[model samples]
Target chain A: MIRALFPVLAILAVWVLLADGALACAVCSGGDDDVKVKDSYVAATIFMSLLPLCVVGGGFLFLRHRYRATPDE
Target chain B: MTSRTTSLRVVTNPRPPVVPSAVLGMLLFLFTELMLFAGLISAHSIARAGALLGWPPPGQPRLPLEETALNTAALLLSGALLIVAQRVFARDKRRTKPWLTASIALGAFFVIFQGVEWVGLIREGLTLTSSTHGGFFYLIIGIHALHAVAALIVLGMNWLRLHRGILAQSTFAAGQVFWYFVVGVWPILYWRVYG
Candidate 1:
């Protein structure tokens, strides 16, 4: 089951990374925050970013269910 | 040339349409907008860090956060109302006009609030060239503002169909998808900008 879910998880990860990568850089606008980008290895949190992805991906899946998914062939 | 019955059968097929391409199209358009915002964020971040100029190129003013936040709230509320409108229309036609009217009114109000905020902000000394923050403010909120205007116009047209009793439930679903996106994406921008 875990292996089968990998593709969906991967797609979902890419979705979040693509979005959160931009936002991570986006929120730091104060000129003197002293954010070290190039040399520092920061441990990013799944809690902050991944939660949003799960919700968005799940929203899309719900929409697909409500509107697109159909019965019969 | 005379196969109306067969065409009807095809239209009335037992299986429902997948709408995969349409879903993909929406996602792609959203991705493009993300790229646009990403570019703005990158420019702003680098400049803020002194990697580039101190932004605004020396002629712009800081944005008035107090007023813009009000407009942000307006837009957020409009989205909530739109969902309400869609839900109302999903069941019965009689309830459609009320919800549609509420949605349309809220959307128009949101746009008007944005306009008023922009005009007031500019008068108070903020401009696209005021400073890095000023430029970022204008570019980020301005793009979203433009999208808001376009969405209101589209919703108005869609509203006309609903008022005239010509729209289908499925079509409402289509419009709602885009509307939700417009509403859904704003908080992220608002938080970043206002912060």
Candidate 2:
């Protein structure tokens, strides 16, 4: 099994090395060095990333509470 | 002589769902919609920040902040009315009709007010192709308006069913989930695009 995973690990290492080249697009790079733009990009990224987690997590917690409140039949 | 026939019976006890399936489905749909709005708002923010001449582009007509605030208040009150309707529905279904009617009326008022606001903005030269500000404003707010209209339609249908006394608890819950999403997401859009 170890020998079988060696090629996959090697390919992953190569992909990681070239990840920066993959993000050279204008959208990914913000296409400008303006301070406000950069800040907006950062803030937006955080907002977008955390929003789904919060929503899904909250929903899950709600369901768990409901389940706990429900009596066993 | 000892041939005996036996009948088999399977006893089943089904437990109620933690969340009704319809409400859960609505919640799932709203989750995706929330992400869509998040993307749109994020794009708008990035674009606004990149603008060199500052936001609203210099020549664009300013958004009607105070007027829209009044409209926002109406939408919020409509949402509050819906909550009251739902509570009344739990206790006495007969009395929920008035509260539900009031909520729908306010929602309609909000949509009509927004339409007037759009007409005024367009006359002031805020067309979609006029400026980046115009483009983002219409794109984001227009999507929101579409959602509001669709939610209104759903609520209208719910009202009809209630009038007929055929609305199921799950169905009403589903409609509430959708309308609440429309109500809840508005303030954020207003802040981001208008403010």
Instruction: Output the number of the lDDT-best candidate.
Output: 2
* CA lDDT for candidate 2: 0.90
- Best of the candidates, TM-score: 2
What ranges in model 1 sit over 4 Å off? A1-69, B1-12, B20-24, B51-61
Model 2, residue B84: C-alpha shift (Å): 0.5
RMSD of 1: 9.2
Candidate 1 per-residue lDDT, tens place, A1-73, comes to 9999999999999998786332244434432344553211121232334544765787578767856546666
**Global lDDT of each model?**
0.66, 0.90
Candidate 2: which pairs clash?
none
True contacts kept of 1: 0.24
Taking the candidates in order, what DockQ does each have?
0.15, 0.58
Q: Please, what are the lDDT tens digits per residue for candidate 1 over residues B60-148? A: 55555677677667767777887888777777776777766777677778778777878887897887776557777878878887877
Tens-digit per-residue lDDT, B1-195, candidate 2: 698899986647667788899999999999999999999998889888888887788989999999999999999999999999999999999899999999999999999999999999999999999998998898988888898899999999999999999998999999999989989999999998989
